[model samples]
Structures are given as structure tokens and as C-alpha cells.
Target: MERTGRMETITYDCIREAAARLKGAAHRTPVMTSRTLNKQSGREIYLKCEQFQRGGAFKFRGAYNTISRMTEEEKQRGVLAYSSGNHAQGVALAARLSGVPAVICIPTDAPPVKLAATRETYGAEVLTFDRLTTDREAFGRQVAEERGLTIVPPFDHPHIIAGAGTVALELLEEVPDLDAVITPIGGGGLLSGTSIAAHGWNPKIRVFGAEPKLAADTYRSLQEGKRVSIDPPSTVADGLRATTPGVLTFPILQSHVENVVLVTEEEIEDAIRFALLRLKTVIEPSAAVALAAVRKGALPRDCRKVGVILSGGNIDPSLLAQLWEREATKI
Candidate 1:
């Protein structure tokens, strides 16, 4: 299993080193489970609860890993990044801790909670753009050049992928016998990293991704065996709305990921509600997709031991209330 080309830097060794770096810094987020969910799915579901992570998402792992490894001059020059929400907060918090200034470009429609945390809690300079009309990468690069700031990509970078892989490493170390693992796919960072971690730990462990149908670029990319772009996704699961898979991530996903399961908007919302009611957890829509796949029987019946990454829980209160109201009427 000599991986030659693209993802050489996102190896198990890289992830291990990242885990070492993040040992005392990152929270070893709890692995949660519900008997009710297990009975309904007929599987032992271990939810890797990353909503409890710093910045309220697993993005902190990659952000810190990338920032901490920078040269003293690079850190002083600071970093620029663009993210819809979670990654912005991650970079903001990480850069603050590392004494490096961070400038984050976020969409105007990003969750208010996320934007506030990035600016107020972490003290990052915030820039806003129309998500549908503006190209975030180009804008971020231009800003970085103007300020001599290094661009901290949300998911495409090697350090980001390696850092994210540590989630799966922690999961396997605790559970040790997971038959399959599923995570939400945005730009493919978490899933690609989890693929490396799962296979590296035990090649027999299966890896899959759960995605919102409204934002199914990763789903289509896997089907066509090439990257595909979609219009800016309009979905409640805002965190999973990446238009295309990353160049680095697509190759890792193509080589390692088994398949991606697409869940409808309704399914995603239902999972969010179920988490609040049944599991006594408040998971955001992006995190709920993984649970939705299990509840909808997206995996094989024989996948008796399953691991699901509950990616985040940074929903705005107003949005949560709206979702509850909408779901209540349907019931």
C-alpha cells in the first residue's frame, strides 16, 4: 500500500505527530451513544462528539496544527483565511493562542454565532462577502498578498488533513473495534483524514461520508471519479456546503473513501431534532447528517459497530427556534 502521488503528506505519521502536538491543547471530546438510537439502527453507534471541541468544531485541530508549525517570521506576518463559519473561528482562536494575527473572510449569511465568536471571542479581523457572488479563495489570496499574510485554507492543506485525522485515531483508540466510520464531507478534509486514520489503524474498517443532498459535490465527485462543481449550496447544513472537493482531498478520498451517502434536507433536520430530544444533545445540521445516515439505514445491516462524527454544534439560537417551529408543524 505505497501511496505515491498526491496525499503523501497526509499520512499516518503526519497525523500521529499532529496528535502529539494537540495532546494537551485540544479537548479529547467525548464519545457519546444513545441506547434509543442504537436500538432503532440495530448497531452500536459511537458518536465522536466534536461539538464539544474548541471553536465548537473539529476545525480547531487543523487550525492549531497549521499555525503552531509556522516559522517565527511567518507567525509574525500573520495568516489570512476564508471559511463559511467553523474554520474561521478555528483559525481565529488558534492564531490568537499562537500570538499571530488572523484575518478571516466569511460569508455575509454565515451563522451569527460563528461570526461573533470569531470577531469578539478571538479578536480576529473579519471580512464579509456575498457567498454566491464572490470567490472566497481569490479574495483571500488578494488580501493575503496585500498584507503579506499566509493563507490558512479550510481543508485543502496537508497539515489540516493530518490534524483532522487525529479524530479517527482517538476514536479507534477508545473503541478499537469499529466496523465502519462515517463523517460529514465538506471540502473532504475530515473524511479524507478519517480514511487514513481508519485504514492505518485497521485496514478492515470501512470509511464513508454523509452529505446533504443540496450540497452534494463530494457525492458527485466520487461517482464521476473526478472533481465536480455545483452552484453555491443553499441548505440548512451550512457547514457542509462546499461547492467542490479540494484538489488534495479528492485524491485521498478517491483512493480511500468507500462511498458517500446523501441525506435530504428533511432527513438532516429530523436528525437535528432527534439529537436534541432523544440524545439530549444539540447538534447542528452539518453534524446531524452522519446520524441521519444511520437512522435512514444508509449503511449495510451488517455494519453492527459504527462510528459517527458529530462534527459541530454552533447553531444560532434563532435558527434553532425556526427549525423547531417548522418541524413541529409537520408533526
Candidate 2:
């Protein structure tokens, strides 16, 4: 990848500082080695189970890091955000923890469980919009203007990226000799952070991003040497459905990430099943993309002892039921 010269400054030190901020706040999610994954991939696989992290996803790290840093006046005025689900819940929880009111703009089509969790579970005000016909960012900004709320976007902000990097920071600290790290990419924050953290630890460590083939904007963006936009994806991995890479995140990703791999919808579903039945962990479709890419041979041939971030485990009840129905039919 060519140097874009427009990278915002996020060094290993930034990630370390974020880690310091999150030390007591965020969960030090466990790192597990799956025998079945090792056997199938023919390499030792270290799975960083971020699903077990607070709010049932890694988004909590970013949300808490961002919201906790707000000024007292800003906290009093509250925060606003837009996300499909996990980030909404993360921000909602973080805001509540900081005694800051929050208003979240979510797509009406987002999973019902996520909606309920954001509103009823976390007590954040939930506003719904038509994701298909509306621009969520513009809407969020408009609302922020009207209400004087500070915006904490899903991925893109420097603090968010630094906080997300803590996932890799913890992974590398726990498993120091890993050859590479791979994680799902939505708007590039996680991958960008992962890349920086991995390379910061050991410049030789390769970093990769996984995306649904149906929602491969980052992959296309990396290939074209510029950010690319896609039509809103219809993939089951709803959380991975960003139409474009964030402008700020793209340059960091292009600088450090080795490649962005695309996985099919079938691949993602199979990964979900594999996690439940074989690995004995429940992961949502968005979280399954990294494992699916690995199973699809997305890693380098020489790479061994790879760390995979299972980004979240917030599957909607309806989707889990559908998977169960299919499993029973196969039986």
C-alpha cells in the first residue's frame, strides 16, 4: 500500500494511554485456543473473545474511552451517536456509566434485540431512521446540532480507534509471539487500531481485515487506492454493513493492514455454527467474518499462531432461531 500522507497521529503510545484509561473500566477479555480451529487451520489459533467484553462486544472499549473523556458541561449536555446495534449499546452503557444522557440514532431495521437493549436495557433515547433511504451521519449531525449533543461515531474518531486498538494491545500482551492478527472491519477503526498495535509490538507482525463479500467497501477501497462506496449491503452481518470506509481511518488502514479479505454470507453463517457447536462460544454474524476468512485461507502460508478478534457476540434471537431450525432440519 502506498503512503497517503494524511494519517492522523495514533502511535503505540496513544493505544497504551487508551489502555490506561480502560484498565479498570473495560474487561480484559480472555484469549482462548481452539483445538478444532488449530486442527482445521493447521496452525495454532489464538481467539481473543471480545464477545465476552462488556456490552457483549469490543465497541465498549471505544465508547467508554470516548464518553468518559467528555467535559463536564458536554456530559451535562449529553452525547449523540449512530450505529446499527453494538456501538449503540456500547455508547449507551458508557454514557450511563458516566451519568451522561445519550440519544442514539439507529436504523429502524436494526435487530429488535439491539433496539430494546439500547432503549429499555441501557435507558438511552432511541431514534429510528430508514437506513435504506436516509443518510445516518447527516441525520446524526443534524440532531447533534439541534440538541447540542457531542457525537461519538461508531468508528473513525481518533479516540475510538485508540480504544479499539486496546483489543490488540491486550492480545499481544497475553500472546506475545503471534505471527499475525485479523479482525472484522466496518469503517476501519478496529483494523486500523489492530494494525497499529500489532506492528507497534513487532513490526514483522502482519495485520489483516475481514469483510463480508457483500459489503466489501474497505477491500475495494484498498484495491483502488482511495475510499470506495457501495450500496448498503444486504448481508446477515448487519454490524459490518458500512457503505464506505471512514476518510480518517482509510489512510491508517492502507498504511499498516496487509490485505482485506472478503467472505461470503454462507461462510459467515458456517462460522457462527462452528463457534457454537465446535468452539462452544456464541458469536454474531459480524463477529464470524474473521474466522470465516481464516477458514477460507485468508492468512499467509507462513503465518502461525494467529490472533483473531471475535469482535462481538450479540446475535439477535430471530437469527439464532433460524440457525437452530436449520440445524434441526439437518438432523
After superposition, the stretches of candidate 2 with alpha carbons farther than 4 Å from their true spots are: 1-7
C-alpha lDDT values of all predictions = 0.93, 0.93
* TM-scores vs. true structure, each candidate: 0.97, 0.97
Please write out the lDDT profile of model 2 over residues 133-245, one tens digit for every residue: 99999999999999999999999888899899999999999999999899999998899889989999999999999999999999999999999999999999999999999
- List residue ranges in candidate 1 displaced over 4 A: 1-8
Quality of model 2 by C-alpha lDDT: 0.93
RMSD of each: 1.6, 2.3
| lDDT against true structure, model 1 | 0.93
Itemize residue pairs with steric clashes in candidate 1: none
